[model samples]
Target: MLAVHFDKPGGPENLYLKEVPKPSPREGEVLLKVAASALNRADLLQRQGQYDAPPGASSILGLEASGYVAELGPGCQGHWKPGDSAMALLPGGGQAQYVTVPEGLLMPIPVGLTLTQAAAIPEAWLTAFQLLHFSGNVQAGDSVLIHAGSSGVGTAAIQLTRMAGAIPLVTAGSQHKLQMAEKLGAAAGFNYKEDDFSEATLKFTRGAGVNLILDCIGGSYWEKNVNCLALDGHWVLYGLMGGATISGPLLWKLLFKRGSLITTLLRPRDKKYKQMLVKAFTEQVLPHFSTEDPQRLLPVLDRVYPITEIQEAHVYMETNRNVGKIVLNLSQ
Candidate 1:
């Protein structure tokens, strides 16, 4: 099995393809012959030694993949079989040609989507679903603000927010990215590098502020995010790309508005919790992908790179040049 490995994490240069033993399925798991894998910020952080895979998880870089079920482990019968086309949300080890995943994390490739496209779905879509529906409890007609709106999770969040009947307000660094967000169903988009996103959000919602905010930029956008929330609004934090330390007064505003600040990390969660999320998303959102509608939900792919070009893919991602997911075609 050829897998991406690193000796000591520092940069993308550390990553190299090496021949390693293929992983086998354990109880309640399935072995997938990986067809494709997607890149995420977490993968970059892991490569640089900033993030570590959870205990007992594979040290491989990828978090999600699309593949065919090569074999099923004991206690994993009746749901899947050999040769089944599936995508999975993995804790780690997706960068390899073969990955063992829990059965619950596997989703059949939806109709109208190729395996390569499905490869981009699991991590971004599931994270967006969890943030908007499970954590934020966003309801129809709610105004939700999403920062980094052109990111993988950001693009998914925009589509999911619209699908749930909420108005999505997005913030991106460029006009082109903002336009992409709007094309994906965001009600309004703000260029955060040039404009105050908080003020723009408030104006978009007619000075009422938004019902929820999904933010990845941490300290730099903290105060503004707090100010952009409506009374009893929910603010969900999933990443801290802009540093973690926050200063300034916030307790008073939080108290005055009865706001809730929630933070989550998906990789460290137990299997049962991930199982629940997978089930919920499959039932609630997967149907939309196959539905006969003009606004069908789908994974947005920014670019595809062969496994040999993984380093270049990382470089492109670091430049923030992608409007959606950057995928690696492992089978290429």
Candidate 2:
């Protein structure tokens, strides 16, 4: 097996494809032959030593992958065998050609999707789904705001928000990104650089504010998110791309608005919690895939770089030059 490993944490330059021992499945686990893996901001943090794998997780740095089952461990059940196409959200180790995963975390590839595209869904879509449905407690006709509307998570957020019958308001850096979000079901888009999102969100809601907010960029958005929430609304914080800090006065003001601040980290979340999320995604959302083909099941990637070109992929993501997921194709 080959994997992207780093001896010293730094930038993309630190990533190198190296031969490593193939991981074998343990009890209740399964081994996968990785076809594709996608990059995330967390991968960047891991590369720079800012993030560490969860306790007992692999030191290898990939969070999601699409692959085929190569081996199954003892105590696993259900209808599965060698060559079953599947996608999974892993805490790490997805960068390798062969990695072991807990059977509970893997899901059969949704109908109408290729293994590569399926790789793009597990982490981003799961995160978006959890944020909008589980944390936000969205209801039909409710209003929601999502930041980073062109990100992988952002793209998934737009689609899930629409599916739940909620109006999705998005903030992206460019009009092209905003347009992309609109095509994906976002009802409104804002240029975060040019507009004050908090003011815009309130105005868009006719001064009532939104019922929920899915915030990936923290820092200033934290304060503005508080200002943009309707009374008793929930704000789900999933990432801090900008910064991570919460002010006392902000908490006081949120108390006034009856806003509840909820934060979650997928990797560190309890296994039972993640299992619940995986179950929810499988039962409630996976069944909705269009019967026609996979394009509707998952968005197309803007770029696919070989595992050897991981550096370039990281650079592209840092520049935010790509829309949708940027995946590493092991076949290349």
Candidate 3:
């Protein structure tokens, strides 16, 4: 099987196309003929050796893929067979022609979506859904502020927030991205490069602040989030794109104001929590992507590169030049 592999992670240049041995189904896993895989910020961190795959997990460089079932391992049952079209969010190993995932992790793809487009769903959509509903506790009529609104996660957040009857406020560096968010149901957009999102957020909420904030910019946007939240609002952080330290007694201030803060990672979640997330996502949201109804949920794909061009894909992401998701099309 031809797959992208890296010996020692550093830059995108480290990725190369090589014919590795094909994997066989394990006791509880099933093999998939991979059709496509999508990029994520976590992939960038992994390529830098800052992140490590789990114990016994694949050292591959992808998180989400769409594919068809090749064969099921023993003890697996209930409606799956060879050539069944599916998509999965695996522990790793998405950048390949074939990979195995636990049977329960796979979800049937909607009929209208190509394998290339279906590859974009799993990680971004799951992250957005978990933050807004599971952790942030967002509800209908609530106001939520999301950072990096042009990002893949941002694109998903805007759409999901609107679905729950919440108004989404977004921030990005460019007007083009802001317009993209607007088209996806963001009620308010801010330019963090030139505008003060804290002030703008206050104005948008009539000085009441927002009920929840989903942030990844960390130190660069942390203090601003503190200034922009409604009383008792939930503030969640999942990444630190900026510096990670604080110089003052910020915890005491937050305690005084009765605000809540949480930082979470998806990889460390218990199996049940992850399964719950995947199940809920499949039930409440995944059905919207059927061929009959035409409810497409993919973010704008700025570029799609073959598995051999992994190096170039990394360069594009590192340059911060893309507006939405950039994917690796393995199906072709």
Candidate 4:
């Protein structure tokens, strides 16, 4: 099997395909014949020696993939069989041709979606679902501000927020990205590079402030996030795209608003938790993607590159040129 490899983590230039041993399924696991994998910011970080894979996880770059079940290991429940089409949220190794996954983490591909589209789900959708529901505790009628509004998780969050009857606000760097976000169901979108998003959010809500904030930018947006948070709002921090250090009275401002600061990382979470999240998402959200409803969920895809172009894909993502996911076709 060929897997994406890097000798010393540094840049996309270091990424290459090497003939590595195919992974085998362990107890309660399934060996998937991967067809496609999707890119994420975490992949770039891991490549740059910033993020490490979870303990005992595969060191390969991908965090999500779509494939067919090739084999099932012992103690696996009878829920899946060989040749079943599935997609999964992986800790790592999805970029490889063959990767093992816990059977519990596998989801049947939604009807009418190709393997390429399903490949874009798992990590992005699951993370968005987790942030909006599990971590943020979003409620109907709530106003939620999602940063990086055109991102994979951001697009997913917009739709999910609308599904929950919440008002979704977003911040992107360009007018085109902002328009894309609004088309996906955001009540309003702001240009973070040109406008004061916090002020815009406050104005959009008529100065009422947002009930929840999905913040990927850390210290750089702390004051602004606190400014737009409603009384008792939830601020969920899942990424640090900006710097991590704060120079202001973050605690003081948040305290004044009675805001709750919550931090979460899905990749490092226990298997049981991921299984629970997958089950909930499958039951509650998966069907929407297959429905005829005009507003049914969709996985936004920016581009599909052959696995051989992994370096180029990374370069594209690093430039922040994608409005959604950048997929790697493993079947090619």
Backbone clash pairs for candidate 2 read 112-294
The TM-score between candidate 2 and the true structure equals 0.96
Q: How close is candidate 3 to the true structure, as a TM-score?
A: 0.96
Q: TM-scores of the models, in the given order?
A: 0.98, 0.96, 0.96, 0.99
Residue-level lDDT of model 4, residues 217-285, one tens digit each, is 988999999999999999999999988999989999999999999999999999999999999999999
Candidate 1 lDDT tens digits, 1-332? 99998999898888889999998888999999999999999999999999999999999999999989999999986799999999999999999999999999999888888888999999999999999999999999999999989999999999999988999999998989989999999889999888998998888888899999998888888889888899999999999998998788877877788999999989999999999999999999998888475679978999999999988999999999899999999985
In model 1, the Cα lDDT at residue 272 comes to 97
How well does candidate 4 match the true structure in TM-score terms? Answer: 0.99
- Residue ranges of candidate 2 with Cα displaced over 4 Å: 246-248, 293-297
What lDDT is reached at residue 284 by model 3?
92
198-301 per-residue lDDT for model 2 (tens digits): 89888989999999888888876877888889999988989888888765588788899999989877877776788789989998888666466343545557
Worst 10 residues of 1 by lDDT: 286-295
Q: List the residue pairs that clash in candidate 3.
A: 35-331
Instruction: Report, for all candidates in order, the number of backbone clashes.
Output: 0, 1, 1, 0
- Give the worst 10-residue stretch by lDDT in candidate 3: 291-300
- In candidate 3, what are the lDDT values of residues 1-332, reduced to their tens digit? 98888788688878898889999988778899998999888888988988887777787878889999999998787568998999888778899999988787788887678887778888888889999988899999999999999898899999889888899999998999999899888998999889999999999898999999999888877778888888899998988897688767678767865899988877656556777888999999887777565545655677898877888999999987787788898876
